[model samples]
Target: MGTADGDGLREFYSAQQPRLVGVVSLLTGSRAEAEDIVQEAFVRLVPRWGKVSRYDAPEAWVRLVAVRLAANRHRDRSRLTGLFHRLPREQAAPDPAEAYGGDLEQALAGLPMPTRQVVVLYYVCDLSVAQVADTLGIAEGTVKSRLARGREALGAALRSDDHA
Candidate 1:
C-alpha cells in the first residue's frame, strides 16, 4: 500500500472500528470475539487497501471480511466439537442477563445463520439491500428473502415469548 493508502486506511479504521465491532458482536453474540474479528479484518485489509479503498464502500468490505471470518470460526467450532466430544468442555463465562436485553436477543439467537446474518447486516448494520448482496456475494433477491423471513421469525419468536 502507498503512504496515501496507509493514511486513508488509518482514518477509516478509526472511524469504522466501533461500528464494525457492533455489527460483529451482534452476529457472534460475543463482544470480545467481535472485536478480535474486526481487528483481524482490518489487518487483512491493510495489505489490500490500495485495491479495496477504491471501492464505493470500503467499510462494507471490512465488514464482509469480518463476518465471513466469524462464520468460518463458527463452522470450525462445530467441527471441533464433534472431534473433541470425548473431552470435557470448559464452562463459558456467564453473560449478564441485561447485556444485550431480553426478547430481541433471544429472538436473534433463535434465527438460522443465513437469516440472522441478513437481519444483522441489513437492519442492525443499516446496509442497503444492494450493499448486503455485494457484501455476502449473494443475489439481492436472496438478501430480501432472508430479511423478510428473518423479520417474520423474529416477530414470531417475540410473540411467543410474550405469550409465555
Candidate 2:
C-alpha cells in the first residue's frame, strides 16, 4: 500500500478500533478475544483496503468479519470442550460488561449467542432491524423474533436481580 493508503488506514483504525472492540467484546463476552478478533479483522482489511476504503461504510465490513470470527471461535471452542470435557481457560482481558455495569452484562451473558448478537447489534450499534438482519445474514423476521426474546429475557433477568 502507498503511504497515503497507510495513513488513511491508520486514521481509520484510530477512529474505529475501540468501538469495534467494545462491540465484539459484547458479542464474544471476552474483551481479550474481542481485541484479537477485531485486530484480525483489521489485518484482513489491510489487503482489501483499496476497495473497502472506497465503500460507504468500511467499518461495517470489519465489524462483520470480526463478528463471524467470534462466532467461529465460539463454535470451535464448543466442539473441543464437548470432545475433551476440558475447562475453559481464564481470560486476562477485563470484563467487557464491567464497562456497562454488572447486572446487564451478566444478563446478556445468559443469552444464547444468536439472541445476544441480535440484541447487541440492534441496541448497542443502533442498527435498524433490516441492517441487523443483513449483518447477521438472517431474515428480518428472525432478527425481530430474536430481539423480542432478548428483550423479554433481559427484562426478566434485570427485574429478578432488582428484587433480589
Candidate 3:
C-alpha cells in the first residue's frame, strides 16, 4: 500500500477503534478479548483497502465483521469447553453494579441477537433505519419493525430496572 493508503487505513482504524471495541465488548464480555477482536477486524480490513474504499459504507462492513467474529469467539469457547480442563476467564462474566449502574448495559447484553443488533445500530450507533437495513441486508420495513420491537424491549427492561 502507498503512504496515502496507509494513512487512510490509519485514519479509519483510529476513528473506529472505540466503537468497534464497544461493540465487541458487548458481544464478548472480556475487555481484553474485545480489544483483540477490534485489532483483528482492522487486520481483516487492511488487505481489502481497495474494496473497502469503494464501499459506500465501510463502517457497516466493519460492524458486521466484528459481530461475526464475536459470535465465532463465543462458538469456539463453547466447543472447547469440554476439551479444556480449566475454566475459561471469558466465560466468567464481569461483576456489574446491581443497584443502578450498568443495569442498562446488562439489559442490552441480555437481549436476543436480532433485538440487540437492531438496538445497537439504531440507538447506540445512531444509525438511521435505512442505514441499518442496508447494513443488515434487510428491508427498510423490517428495520423499522425491528427497531420498534427493540426499543420496546429495551424500554421495558429499563423501566423494570428503575422500579427495582
Candidate 4:
C-alpha cells in the first residue's frame, strides 16, 4: 500500500478498533478471542485498505472480516479439540432479559446458515437486498425468501421458548 493508503488505514483502525473489539468480543464470548479476531481482520484488510476505504462503511468491512475470522477460529478449535466455539449462539446473544426480552437470539441461532446470514446481513449489517444478494452470490428473491424464513423461524423459536 502507498504511504497515503497506510495513513488512511491507520486512521480508520484508530477510529473503529474499540467498536470492532466490542462487537467481536460479544460475538466470540471471549475478550482474548475478540482481540485475535480484530488483529486477523486488520491484517487481512491492510493490503486492501484503499479498496475498503472507498466503501460507504469501512468499519463494516472490518467487522465482516473480524466476524469471519472468529468463525474460522471456532472451526479450527473444533478440528483440534473435537469441539470449539459452539456455544449456543442465541443464548450468548446479549440479553433481552437484561435489555428487555424482545426476540430470543437462541431461537434465531437455530435457523439454517443461509437464512441466518441473510437476516444478519440485512438487519444487522443494514445492507440492501441487492447488496445482500450480491454478497451471497444469490438472487434478490432468494435473499428475501431467506430473510422471511429466518424471521419466521426466529419468531417461532422465541414463542416456543416462552411456552416452555
* Among all candidates shown, the one with the greatest TM-score: 2
lDDT agreement of model 3 with the native: 0.76
Q: How many residue pairs clash in model 4?
A: 4
Give candidate 3's error at residue 16 in angstroms.
1.4
lDDT of 2 by residue, 1-164 (tens): 99999999999999999999999888877799899999999999999999999999998999899889988997896686555534344533344444443377778877888899899999999999999999999999999999999999999988877876
Model 3 regions lying over 4 Å from their true place: 27-30, 74-102
Candidate 3 lDDT over residue span 1-164, tens digit each: 99999998889889999988987676666679989988888889899987897788788788888877776776786566545535576665443333334366677765666667777778777888887787777899988887788778778878877886
Where is model 2 poorest over a 10-residue stretch in terms of lDDT?
Answer: 87-96
Cand. 4 Cα-lDDT: 0.71
State in Å the error of residue 149, model 4. Answer: 1.4
Which candidate number would show the highest lDDT if scored against the true structure?
2
Instruction: Show the colliding residue pairs in model 4.
Output: 90-105, 90-106, 96-100, 96-101
Give the higher-TM-score candidate: 2 or 3.
2
Worst 10 residues of 4 by lDDT: 95-104
lDDT of 4 by residue, 1-164 (tens): 88888888888989988777866564455578779889888998988887889998777778777766766775675475433235565644443324334344445445555676677668766789998787667899999889889878878777766886
Q: What are the per-model numbers of colliding residue pairs?
A: 0, 0, 0, 4
Return the TM-score for each candidate structure. Answer: 0.80, 0.87, 0.73, 0.63
Show the lowest summed lDDT stretch of 10 residues, model 1. Answer: 92-101
Candidate 2 deviant stretches above 4 angstroms: 84-102
- Candidate 4 positional error at 94, Å: 22
Ranked candidates (TM-score, high to low): 2, 1, 3, 4
